[model samples]
Target: MTIKELETRTGMTRANIRFYENEGLIAPSRLPNGYRDYSERDVHKLLKIKLLRRLQISLSDIKAIVRGNRLLDEVLEVQLQTLQQAQEDMSLAASVCETMLADHVAFSELNAMQYLMTIETGARERRSDYFEVKGDELPQVHQPWRRFFARFFDMMLYSSLWSASMMLFFNQNPSLQSDASSIIEGFIVLMIMLFVEPVWLHFFGTTPGKALLGLKVESDDGGRLTYGQGVARTWGIIGKGLGYNIPFYNLYRIWKSYRMCSDLETLPWDEDIAYTLKDSKKYRYVTYIGGIALLIFMLYTATAMKLLPPNRGDLTVADFAENYNYYLKYFQMDSDQYYLDDNGQWAEQEQNGSTVYLGIGFSERPVFTYEVVNGTLVAVGFETHIVGEERWVGSNDQYMVLSGLAFANGQKTVGLYSKLSQELVNAIDSHTFESFEFSQDGIQMRADVTYAGYNDFDSGVLIPMDGASSFTYDLLYEIRSNNE
Candidate 1:
């Protein structure tokens, strides 16, 4: 029979059935798929447990009887005596209440000391141990909210560290796309916390967040947890308390844990563990908030720095290329425009047909070439043949290409405007097509636009749009430092 069928037959809740099983009162066999396979014996056993529980039998006694350590009748006899003693106490309390009502006793004038003395005397005469409560069994304090926030703080700290490390060392950014990559990233962070949290608990008895909240997780003996105990407890919290942080199941587990804590019941993870809380000043909360805020700030700062181009100070050719590539990648620009060859020289991306940029068609992609003087980049330039099969040199397409070249030369996206002269900027903005050159602050800029064509052959055949009859053109743009 299934558990649901068992629930129906025995008239017991799933929780009750599971609790009894956990207490070793009933042991069900497991099926191939890891589900419990209950039998008729389990149904009968659960019914017996229900009846015994109704008779106020404790689970410990029931477990001993189920295990054959004690006879059922013997346990029943002890329970019956305990119940008879409880009945006597209730009768004595009821008699006192009846007497008070018969005398019409008012609240303010009630003889409390007289009633207590009477009850105490009755209990002594009956030789009952019910009123002799043990002081050592007092309930321990529970701080569910504090514990939850402390764990949350620790998780956030771990996530931030992971993000910063990936961005700074690995040059990898968190994925903005909604995909399994995000879930995988979260899993990695959880794994990191799993291993790291145990070390903190073993050595310090608390994590950073727990320290801030004045909370400590100790062994039952009130000492720091051993490494093995720490691992077990942390794993228990991840599995039973947090449901391994799986989406909807995590919420259910969290609610269940909260209820257990609120009811002052020992959490499954803390079964043989102890939690101690010191009197914390109110400023601890402030510090915790500040710590979380600082982590978030650092995470964002790292992301921004990773996305930005390299610094502008006297850069080598490789450094300049790195900055340029960073801009292209960050903006998701077309990456097929250029590439580095085997000798580290910029080479145009090869294609079967012409490529277009800023509405202007070209026979080849523009390639960037740089001159390095004394290990510092001093000049950069590129030239490409523009297809004129259906376009003219003075058309708007030419103006658009010129404008794009001006923007590219200024390195506008990277905020490196010092590379372009103001005179060149104004001329380009004014759509001045004639060859012009200007220098400012040791930086020189020039542009050369020509209308021409050339015959190109490949495999003894004329390449299309490469003959002099075709009205093709070429554009050359360059920027150089006079210091070179």
Candidate 2:
């Protein structure tokens, strides 16, 4: 008979049946397809086991009787004596309860000591073979929340570090802003945690998060886990507890693990390993919160730094392009901004017609000129012209144009001349002019603003032309060596 048929015949749940099978109580043969084939004899054996269990016989005694290690009558005789003694104890307890009720004793007024003495005396005289219930089979200690938060803290720390590394070293933004990127980053962090967690467990018996939360993972012998054991336990946690952090399924696995933990069942990862937690204190929690805040701050600061170009020292043309792109992306100003081509030439997005700069439309591309001293870009300049036919310059348009120039020029404080001298911007800020020149600490900045007629495309210079209405701004910045 199949196991289902066996269930029907024996009226036992699949769990119970499987449990009994695991306990070696019954061995059903497997058919060709590897499904259990229960015999009629197996059903009889299950029924007998069920009857014996109802009689309050322990599984060990039943097994002994079934395996011919002990006679059924002998086990029954022992069970009978044990039950009669239990009955007498219960009868004595009932008599005591009746006496207390007859006395109309209030619980608060009742003498617990007196009742305990009477019960003890009665047990000593009547039940000579009685033994005290010490409750040695109590459930193991489990702190599911502490364990969870420790791992959470560790993962957050790892994520922050990984984000900082990616931004600082690779110039790649590791953001969790999108679902796909978040999942990929999360999986990578999980893998990193798995690899590093075992090392901590094996050497120190705890990780930073675990230590903060007063949790430790140890071997069965109450020592730090061996590396191999730690690896196995970590893998168990990743697979069974976290479900490999897969979408949707990870939640299910976490829920299942939580339920098991709440029920005081040993988690699979902790089968042979011991996970100990100390008594929690208020200060630890406060410190943990502060640490989390610090980590978040670190992540934000790294991301901000990544968004800014190298803010100090002489830069290459590529570095200048990076700063340009950073500004473009930061303000979301222009989609057709500049970039360094593969051949180290400056390039812009291909446009259909005219491009807008500082709210002014222009048909010609902006020109970039640079002076490199020994491969170090020492000076850079940008010039663009806006003709009158493109757009009429109202007061607002003129103000915007001037403000844009000031903003662009001020960026030198954080870019080209930033490392050269800090006082350059301070000096510039204290004065106001349509065009100004500032030289300090071997760094020189010159801004020449002029509104004129036409652009000299051939000569590559801004010169006065007849019958022309154009506005042009030229910004020339230079950094000189001490010897020069």
Candidate 3:
């Protein structure tokens, strides 16, 4: 009720409580006599303020937390990180002090090089609490999938060895395989089985997975991993993996996910060794999505799109190595454009609300040949040679294969069968044709040879008639319905 009583309740002096009160971290009311009246809420706020101040949190952050302008966890998270960095610096300084003491060196006798040498040695020996001596170029973090696969490979080997040993020793009895209460067993296993990890790390500077993937776990100074450092690294990795062993089921999963999501490139647990993957490629772009999608893109582009029958068909040599080799290529359509993402997946760029996306069959290649239209891809007439000789596309009638994806009300419509009627197909193909005129009724195909020097006489169907020039409109119901 009073400042004295409030101070007794909060274990803080009246001056500190009043200072917090003035800072608005805690608010108090006045009684009828004009004396300060403290409530239970005020006592609680004062206690929190004292605790936050003791934690070395600035009053500004504490005030924000108290006023609900900031979350306590967010402020505390940033503060904790600052404190952690300070602790690391303190640890390094303490290590340097110990090194000097052990070597019987005095501060007055210390020169720049000798002092610098002490820190360098400290970095190698006590790398867990340090970094930064390695200089400006931080190595790239290994892609997530690389680290995932490496662990997967090593675990597979571990599982195979463990299973084989069990079968050999226990006569393949299923009952002896796993205990009903395996959670406790797993906890014990985590604690006991990984002792040999340090041995492998010491000898090979990596586990089997790291070695197989062309990864090394060496110090920044390029020295072999010390036995103590090996043991620390082993424990760090094991700690990340032990989330499932915590006895409580759901809590264990949450912890496991958090640990696994930690940045793998830096290996926050073990700074003693830097992870290096693929000497040929300094950085690897590994997608968490399936490789099958990319593999399908590659093989389908090569065989189903352009290569099987060996037709250039308006498909350029540049278009078909495809992006499946994991190179991104930009394509601008006349009105709409699309590109392959870094993973070689087709991505459409919205073109002012009128974008066309090609729809190939689940196992099919792109239907229409693509040519650069205003720096983007648009449908182009396909070129082919019959009898192993280059055939005039004007003379040949098979050029209709060049028709591909079209824009239908900002949606993708494939010109495969029923959608391939002259009227519907011209809605899209007309945009790319050198010359085209069509209204709500009769359609006109007018062109003086497409950029590749091929003339179309039968509308946008691209069915060429040799020596036939000028415009021809296809009003045949049979051709339209046959497409259906």
Go through the candidates in order and give the C-alpha RMSD of each one to the true structure. Answer: 23.0, 22.1, 23.9
Q: Give the alpha carbon lDDT tens digit for every residue of 1-484 in model 3.
A: 9999987899988888878777777778888999998999988877888888899999989878877899999998999987887787678788877877888866688665876776678666655446465645435444655566666555444544443444344323222334654554455455444666667767887776656556667766766777788777766666654453565663564345345546433455545556665553433223312333454444333322211212223323244324221111111121324543322234466746654455533211222334344443332333322221122323212122122211111112221222223454454354433434332212222223333324446453344345544433221110110111
For candidate 1, what is the lDDT?
A: 0.70
Q: What is the lDDT, from 0 to 100, of the residue 131 in candidate 2? A: 36
Model 2 segments more than 4 A misplaced: 1-141, 176-178, 311-319, 325-484
Clashes per candidate, residues 3 or more apart or on different chains: 0, 0, 4
Error of 3 at 333 (Å): 72
TM-score to native of every candidate shown:
0.49, 0.47, 0.28
> Candidate 1: deviation at residue 327, Å?
5.7
Question: Any runs in candidate 1 off by more than 4 Å, and if so which?
Answer: 1-141, 175-178, 308-312, 326-484
Give lDDT tens digits, candidate 2, residues 1-484. 9888888999999998999999999999989999898999999999999999999999999989889999999999999998998888888889888888888878889888877777889899886444356434322447778778887898899888888887788666554246887888878988888788889998899998888877777887778898888889888988898888899899999999888989888888787877777768788898888888999988877865654454335556666555555544444445556544422244555566443333223333434556677876666554444445433322122112222222233343444323322254444443222356666445555555444553434332444566555544433223333322
The TM-score measured for candidate 3 stands at 0.28
lDDT of each: 0.70, 0.67, 0.49
Better of 1 and 3 by TM-score: 1
Decoy 1 TM-score against native: 0.49
- Model 1 RMSD in Å is 23.0
